[model samples]
Target chain A: MMHHHLILRVVTKMLVGTIILFAFYVQFHGDFSPGGGFQAGVIMAVAFILYGIVFGLNKAEEVFPPWLVHKLAAFGVLVYAGTGVVSLLLGYNFLDYNAFNPGHPSHGQHWGIFAVELGVGITVTGVMVAIYYAFAGRPPPINDEDW
Target chain B: MVETIINIILFTMLVLTALAIVRIDSLFAAVMLSGVFSLLSALLFVTLDAVDVAFTEAAVGAGISTVLMLMTIALTSRTQKKATRSGMVPFVVVAVTGGALFYGTLDMPNLGDPNAPAQLHVAPEYLAGSIKDIDVPNVVTSVLASYRGYDTLGETAVVFTAGIGVLLLLSGLGRRRRKDEEGDA
Candidate 1:
């Protein structure tokens, strides 16, 4: 159904890769700069969302299925909580990174922050994309000419 | 001096955009204007040295929010209807609330005041401890991930819950309804 816009399709094809690279950069480089999980995850979701807008919802869903998105969202929360659970099992207070490295608290802190941020980034990405899919998938009741 | 000029220019444009959003009758135009407003706000946040917040505002507020709003408009009407009721009461209420908000700002410390209560409390500790504990240069990340670990866990849960709720409301119901229609057909 997406027709008549040759320019948008070409441009999006070129830009999507760059956008994804930038999202990863923001995700990992956040410790040194002004970005983190929330920002990075949203950026990551934007890549897929832009692709869906330029192409079509079906193609986007083929690349990233709804069931997978739901699993990733649930799994992300589990990763976050599982980290705390691991810490508790190691005979430390929940989420105390000192448990990760008994000798070096700072190193433990680094590992903990990384894991936690990864979980956050994953959950945010999944949730945002899932929400996008849910809204976009609704059958359009109005005529296309009405737009 | 240049910063002040930028601030004044941005604020003036921001107010103009808001006024235009209010006056615009076409819902599509209003949605685009709101995206512009968010981008302007993100820029303002950047100028205020809040780059992290600016990034979020730009991505989520301008980017995702604009897409979602456009999709919502697609499923609904494109034009706003003229108000049938008197606007005088709502106008007075809005004016009073706006005036009160402006009045409240007078008692607050100026931006970046070193002696402000916020500056004196755990913020300084966070700034200092981030380097000592997390060994991270970006204090915001360390603070969010380390000091406020439980709080972030809570935030992630909230995001998860919200996503599930939306998926249930939109796709879950819509899918079943569509199946029923197909069966009937």
Candidate 2:
């Protein structure tokens, strides 16, 4: 009787898709809008959290496996930090996008930011999914015997 | 005059909500009130034109954090023991520390001043040229991912840590089928 309600599942799935699309818009349009990596990341995570709540932890894991999430989250940060390290190796200040290109600093900055935002989005979504799985799979109370 | 009245009302509500958090005996009610407090604070941030901060506060503080806290409380305890004064020294120290932090805020830039040091520095450069330079419409994204990518990388690392921590904590306990069968046996 305490299982996830059908309405909750339907509503949450709809909301999750909407939130993901919104996050995509925000991330891509962040160069001119109020949205940024942090906001987009939070919104992206929210979708996974909603899904976990509505569909159950096992189902959530099936969609975003814990192992895959772990690796993807780590890879995301690595992609971001690796960009900076590459710049440093190229003989510029760490994270200096200018070093990413031999010319046109503006283009370099654009490319760098885009890559980093993608990384942020990936890490955010993955970790949020992981958190949902963690909290969801927590052992329920030993009182289910009454059912 | 209306703006002044609105500010006054907002301030009063903030204070009353803080008091409500302390006064509420029910843990669930306190958690709900805390979410309201976060939403109000996010609104205050928006009024200050710190839209980015407002968005984050709304999503994290009011949304995810509240739900997480409620889930934790459900998994843990519904009723809390009455507070005792026998070991209140830490509370006093933390209160004093927090008060000191609040006092330090007096030195911060006046709210919404476009000429504030924060706005005049790298932020302005980013705001003015990010679109032309980055080919993106949202400057916040450009700054976060490109101009200040190192910091974003660190934030992602923090997220990675959280994920790992969750996996480590929950892995063994998740063998629920085996546990259930063993329990039944």
Write one digit per residue (lDDT tens) for candidate 2, span A28-53: 77767677666777788787777776
Task: Estimate TM-scores for all models.
Answer: 0.94, 0.82
lDDT of 1 by residue, B16-60 (tens): 999999999999999999999999999999998989999999998
TM for candidate 2 is 0.82
The residue pairs that clash in candidate 1, if any, are none
True contacts kept of 2: 0.73
Which runs of model 2 end up more than 4 angstroms from their true locations?
A1-4, A86-93, A99-102, A142-147, B86-95, B102-109, B112-139, B170-185
Candidate 2 per-residue C-alpha lDDT over B1-185 given as tens digits, one digit per residue, 9 for 90 to 100? 87677778878998999998887787778888999999989888877767878888898899888887777776777657887766589879989999999999999988777889988888888877776766656565666676666677777888778778876776565577689989999
Per residue, candidate 1 scores C-alpha lDDT tens digits across A55-117 of: 889989998988898898998899889999999999999999889998999999888888888
Q: What is the DockQ score, from 0 to 1, of model 1?
A: 0.83
Top candidate, metric TM-score: 1
Query: Which run of 10 residues does model 1 chain B get worst, by summed lDDT?
Result: B168-177
